[model samples]
Target: MNAPAHDNGRLALMLNELRLPTIGRLWPEFAERSDKEGWQASRLLGALFEHELAERAKRRIERHRNESHLDPSKTLATLEFGLLPMVSKAHVMALASGESWLEKGATILMFGPPGTGKSHLGSAIGHALIDVGYRVLFTRTSELVQKLQAARKSLQLPSALAKLDRFDLIILDDLSYARKDQAETSVLFELIAERYERKSLLITANQPFSGWNDVFPDPGMTVAAIDRLVHHSTIFELNVESYRRRKASDKQSARQRQLPEKNQEGGTTIMS
Candidate 1:
């Protein structure tokens, strides 16, 4: 038989918020059904409610963990078709082997021409590292160099690099995109030297090693930097067609023949 529905005044608000049906609907049904059930039906219902609450707590914890992960939102799914098989196949296996250089400390160099998906691949790897619970710092090569110079002026260079060391993986995207002076080049090389073997470095560049001398400005420093970078690194050369060109062509073809109307509702406000 079921126990009497007590005056649950203390939890009445909570029960109502949980959408638990009131006695008006449930009490009569329980009373009518209790005669047939040998066990206490109310106890069974309470047990079910407790079990559901526990399950919900577990789910909430899992959701929080997933959301807390530094998901860069870069995934293998968004990778362009041309670069997929090569990067995802044996390459992933090679890097993931032994102590996980990707997880531990190693370097990955992705060299290719502009619009060949270099940044996308580097970012995807960073996201993959984050999934493995490694802290990753990502920035464009140009921006990193600029920030380092700014730090030197503020006398915070050491502190800045110290913070960089905390990251398990560092991704420098678009290396050599903007023209860098000799001092900036030296600072960048020093960063690589300092981080050598201490943390994993992921570099994406539009130019190959052969063309890197243009970035370093000094031929001797260029050779030294390239030597240090390639010594213990996995290199991928992407020689694919420009995805940007394809996108541009599609956009051009979709242009309307007639002039589109422009809306200038407010002064100096332009809308197309």
Candidate 2:
């Protein structure tokens, strides 16, 4: 039998007050199914709760993903692993699982030339970690540095860093773009120092260790930053040819093959 309108309204009110939105919306349908199938009270109640929990988990992930600033298109499935032969698929899968390393506040450093898929891999890893319930923030190293510099100028640097601490992992893309000035590098170093051994960092850079002096400006600071990052880190050196360059070459070849040919009479003729 269907619940009376008054009873249904009262139950919805109570559910809303209790903040059980999924259960509130679903219970009516489930109640009908229960009656039709002669499901016991316990079984119906369990089914409702299972759905509520599942929906809550999904919503939580969506909220976290929105806050993460990750590109929805950049996921492990979309990553072109064939172009990145130097990177081990198994190793990336292991990192995606985020097993023991994330808890230990490990780091992932990706060093590669421009267009070599470093940023794509880093963002893919970020998406994977978020799927497994880790909060992640993906931002350009230059942008984050500017924000930190602004916070420092306002004397709220600590508060700013604390806000970032809530994220399980922070992916700093294009770290080489951060200007090599004391003001900018100092705050950047402060962030690295604050998160050391407490939270994870995933950095994508076009520069290697020796070239980081152009990023840090100070020899001592460069060493310190590299030390902390490399301490418990997994490094991926993407030494492959540029993906963009390869794609451009392929497009050129295709266009050349599609071009009209010169016939015996010296007139252009379309390819058959």
- Top lDDT model: 2
Q: Put down candidate 2 lDDT per residue, 1-272, tens digits, no spaces.
A: 98555688899999999989999999989999999999998999999999989999999999999999999988999887888889999999999988988899999999989999888898898899888989999999999998998999999999999999999999999998887763477889999999999999999999899888888868999999999999999999998899668757878998776654335346756556
Model 1 CA deviation exceeding 4 Å by range? 1-73, 82-88, 93-99, 245-272
Which one wins on TM-score?
2
Off by over 4 Å in 2: 1-6, 247-269
Q: What TM value does model 2 have?
A: 0.89
Error of 2 at 181 (Å): 3.3
How many clashing residue pairs appear in each of the predictions shown?
A: 0, 0
